[model samples]
Target: MKIGLYFGTFNPIHTGHMIIANHLAEHSDLDQVWMVVTPHNPHKQKNTLLDDYHRLEMVHLATKDFPKLQPSDVEFKLPQPNYTVNTLAHLQEKYPQHTFSLIMGEDNLNSLHKWKNYEVILQNHSIYVYPRLASGEIDAQFINHPKIHRIGAPVIEISSTFIRESIKNKKNVVPLLPEKVWHYIDHNLFYKK
Candidate 1:
């Protein structure tokens, strides 16, 4: 089985995420996309992040309908300030039978060299990179790597920041999240102080 690891904080899962997972599953060689919910991403701010378990739950709720897409709390059990290299190593040790690939945006691809053990990651794992508007051209140095692939999936501008601000301002976010997910967030007063 070929699995694509779609890692994210998913402060609150939304439709755009689902669309990307579905798009990858249908268009790429990947048979499944595991939405790996990170407890803390070393590259991003951690101050405003929701609880790891809660974020995982939101991802689960949002992706339940797509059998090809699954929500995984794999990084939760691992160490904090989760690093992709470590997670990939652990996953390989845990699931030897399944082939794994990295799923990310072109923006991340541009900064791949700064990541921990990036050379090893690119040499060992295939990457499915979805283009993001205004992300700038993916660096040729990184894109030239044999394992990297530039995906043609349509870009969606939806972002977790936008959703958080909407909730904070008591604005409508129905279009950003799934029906069940919106209800869950509203009931819990998530992102709303």
Candidate 2:
């Protein structure tokens, strides 16, 4: 099976994420897209993030109805910071029979050099980059790489930060989040100011 790893914090899985994952699964060469919920991202601010288990549950509730999209909690047991390189290595070791690919936004690709063991990741795995609103073109060096593919998935400007802020300000985020996710957040009083 060809699995595309779509790694994110998924503070609350929203429609934008679902659209991209579905697009990748249906349009790309991937058999399924696993939304890998990272417990902690080394590059992101830690204080703003919700608990790992809460974030994982939100992803589960949001993706439960999508057959091609699977929510993954593999990083919950991994080390802190949850580096992509380590996750990829671990997944490869654990599931040798499955061919894994990396699904990311074009913005991430622009900063690929800043990541740990990026060269190893590029050389070993296929990267499917979807367009991001305002994210510029990829670097010239990787423009023609065989393993790097730029897909035409629709770009949604909604972000997790925006969702959290809206919730804190008592703004209705029903349009941004999945129904079950919003219900869970509201019922649990998540992100209350």
Candidate 3:
């Protein structure tokens, strides 16, 4: 099986994330797209992040209706400050039968060299990059790489940061998130300021 791993903090899984994942699964050669919920990202600040379990549950709620999309908590049991290279190595050892590819945005591709063992990632797994709102054309270096594939996924400007701010300010987020996800957040009083 070819699985596309869409890694994220998913502070709250919103419509943009869903669209990208679904598009990858439907349009790409991937058999499935797994939303790899990161417990801790080495490059990101942990201050505003919700509990790992909460974020994972939100991903689950948002993806429940899509058979091709599923939520993953593989990073939770790993060490803190999870790195992509380490997770990929672990997953490869555990699921040798599955070929794992990466799903990311153009913005992330801009900083790929900063990631741990990025060269190894590029050599071992394919990358599916979707365009971001303000990101210009992909860098020339990766434009024609055999392992890097640029996809024309529908661009949704909505982001998790925007959703969080709306919730903190008591604004409606129904259109920005899946029905079950919004219900879960409201019922749990999440992101209350």
* Model 2, C-alpha of 84: deviation from truth (Å): 1.1
TM-score of 2: 0.94
User: Which pairs of residues have clashing backbones in candidate 3?
Assistant: none
Please give each candidate's TM-score. 0.94, 0.94, 0.95
Per-residue lDDT of model 1, residues 1-193, tens digit only: 9999998889888889888989999999999999998786556767769888888888888888889999999888887766799999999999999989999998888788889999889878999999898787667787567798888998998999999998999899998898988998998988896
| Best model per lDDT | 3
- Judge candidate 2 at residue 101 and give its lDDT: 92
Ranking by lDDT: 3, 2, 1
What is each predicted model's overall lDDT from 0 to 1?
0.88, 0.90, 0.90
Task: Give the worst 10-residue stretch by lDDT in candidate 2.
Answer: 39-48
lDDT per residue as tens, model 2, 1-193: 9999998888878889999999999999899999998786666777768888898899899889888899999988898766788989999999999988999998888888789998899989999999988778678878898989999999878999999899999999999989999999999998877
Worst 10 residues of 1 by lDDT: 39-48
- Measure candidate 2: CA RMSD: 1.6
Model 1 TM-score on a 0 to 1 scale: 0.94
